[model samples]
Target: MNSVRRHALTGFAGLALVYLLLPIAVVILFSFNDPVGRFNYTWAGFTLDHWLNPLAVPGLGEAMRASIEIAFLSSLTATLLGTPIALALVRYAFRGRGTTNLFIFLPLTTPEVVLGASLLTLFLNLGVSTGFWTIVLAHIMFNVSFVVVTVRARLVGFDRHLEEAAMDLGANGWTTFTRVTLPLIAPGILAGALLAFALSIDDFVITLFTAGAQTTFPLWVYGASRIGVPPE
Candidate 1:
């Protein structure tokens, strides 16, 4: 009976994963389908024209290029900034540590709409005209907290003894960090950076509020939905 229950539980979990991923799978499939659009789902044929075909649609290529650029820069900045914060939280004892943690976690709990609205107001008040850079700044602000949390998780299980050993072996702080500590935590930083990039690219509400005049890929898609996504 226990084994039967375990099998049933595993089956249910598998089904749940399939359900969650079904839409993504469909999008990936239909991205190559004939006459790619929300309406086209025949699966009758396959073509990569949608991805490669120039003049496929207006604004799409430009928006996609912009989104990629913004994602790379913003996620890179967030990871570089957040990694230090995470390292400090994991490795050091400091006054106001709880406050710092709270501030980092606060963004995760904040609603996207609220954060966007607030940022919009601040930019307006500061007389900061918005553009591609503004969007990158907004992406970094929202994505940094996630990076800090993720890298900290990797740091939690890490052995500090390696750093101590490196120090004992006459390696300086920078050498110990770059050679030993960084290599150990590099995967976690990379994973967090990828997550940040995805979030930055997929962002809609915050980008909408903060992007000002610049259009991102998702913004373009949302606008295009008003008019249909054109066939290539």
Candidate 2:
């Protein structure tokens, strides 16, 4: 009976994995497909033209470059800003600390549409024009919460005695942090930054609202979908 149940669970898990991965597998297979026309949805043939000339798609390279720039900037800014906030929350006891922690999650919980609308309103009120900077700022705003959360989770279980030991050995505060604390928390910080980058690159609703004329890669792909998406 136990063997039967184990087999059933294994089968179910395998099915779940396939369900999640089937579309990705199809996409990977079609990456090499040579479409007969503009739309690359249906498989026509297999060719290396798309791979050989990646820049064949008009505006695709520019859009991808813009997306990478924005994602990198936003992730870096969020990581820099959030690391301190996470450290403060974890290492210090201050007034309104609990409230601060709670508010950090508000952005995560709020609907993207509402956040976009609110940011648009704020930018309008401030007489700030929506453009690349606005998109970067919006991405940073959204990404910070995730960065803080990820880093904080890592910091929660960290041992403080290591820091004490470093200090006892004549290491200054800055040296202790740069050499010891930062290294220990590096993995979490990296995880958070990667998450920020992914979210920033994939963002659409907020980018749509905040971007005046600049198009990120995802936005470009979305616009291209109205006509036909090039394989590249």
Candidate 3:
């Protein structure tokens, strides 16, 4: 009976994995398809044309570049801003600390549509024109919370004895942080930055709201979907 149950669980896990990966597998398979028409949905024949000429589609390269740039900027900014906040929250007991934590989590909990709409409204009220910078700002706003949470988690497991030891050895606070503390928490910082980059690059709804004329990769894909998405 235990053996049978184990086999059943294994089968279920395998099935779930396949279900999750089916779309990705299809996408990979279709990338090599040479479609005769604008739509690449139906596999006509396999060709290297799409791979050979990746920028055949207009604005595709530009959109990709814009997305990468935005992602990098937003992730860097979020990490910088969040690291200090994370340190503060973890190391210090301040008034309104709970409120600050609540606010930090609010963006993570809020629906993307609502957050996007709220950002749009705020920008309009402030007379800030929605464009490239606005999209970057919007990405930064959402990404910061993730950065803070990640770095805070890292700090929670940190050994304060290490810092105390460094100080006892005549190292100043800044020196200890730069040499000891920073290196230890670097993994969490990098992870948070990478997550922010992924979120910024993949964001569609929020980008759509904040972007007036600027187009990101997701935005380009969305526009292409109206006609037909090319596998490339």
Candidate 4:
């Protein structure tokens, strides 16, 4: 009976995972297939043309470049800003720390439309230009929580002994952090940054709201869909 139950659970889990990943598999597969139309994919044979043919879609290259730049900048910014907050949450006890942590994660749990609108309003009030800069900032704001949460998990396993040893040897906090703590947690930070980058690059709703005159990849894809897609 136990063996049967175990097999049943495993089967269910496997099916669920496959169901989730099917769309992603289709996207990756379709991204390679360059065809003659959009609705019905004509097999012009398998080619990497869509991925490589920058000028094929006209402005596709520019959109890709913008998305990459924004993703990189925002992820890096989020990592820098999030690490300290994560460290503080992990290592220090402070009043309102729980509240701070809650706020950090609140944006992630909030509706994307609401957060995007709020960011738009904030940018408008500040008279900030809402192009690349606004997109970067908006991405960072939404993605920082992911970095903090990911890094803080790593922080739990971290040994503060190295930091303390550096301090004992007369190193200042900044130096100790730079020389000791930062290096140890670098992997977690990097992973978190990659995750943030993925989120930023794939985002459409928030980017749409915040980007006044800029086009990220998702935005470009969306707009292009509206006008009409050319070859697949």
Which candidate's TM-score is highest?
3
Per-model TM values vs. the true structure:
0.87, 0.92, 0.93, 0.81
Pick the winner on lDDT between candidates 3 and 4.
Answer: 3
lDDT of 2 at 220: 93
**Residue 178 miss distance in model 1 (angstroms):** 1.7
Positional deviation of residue 88's Cα in model 3 after best superposition, in angstroms: 0.4
Would you list the rank order by lDDT, best first? Answer: 3, 2, 1, 4
TM-score of 1: 0.87
Q: Write the residue-wise lDDT of candidate 1 on 79-114 in tens digits.
A: 999999999999899999999999999989999999
Ranking 1 against 3 by lDDT, winner: 3
| Best-to-worst TM-score order | 3, 2, 1, 4
Residue pairs clashing in model 1 are none
Worst 10 residues of 2 by lDDT: 48-57
* Model 4 worst lDDT run, 10 consecutive residues: 35-44
Question: How does residue 146 of candidate 3 score in lDDT?
Answer: 98
> Can you give the lDDT of residue 146 in candidate 4?
97
- Maximum-lDDT candidate: 3
Per-residue lDDT value at 176 in model 3: 100
Give the C-alpha lDDT of model 2: 0.94
Q: Count the backbone clashes (under 3 Å) in each candidate.
A: 0, 0, 0, 0
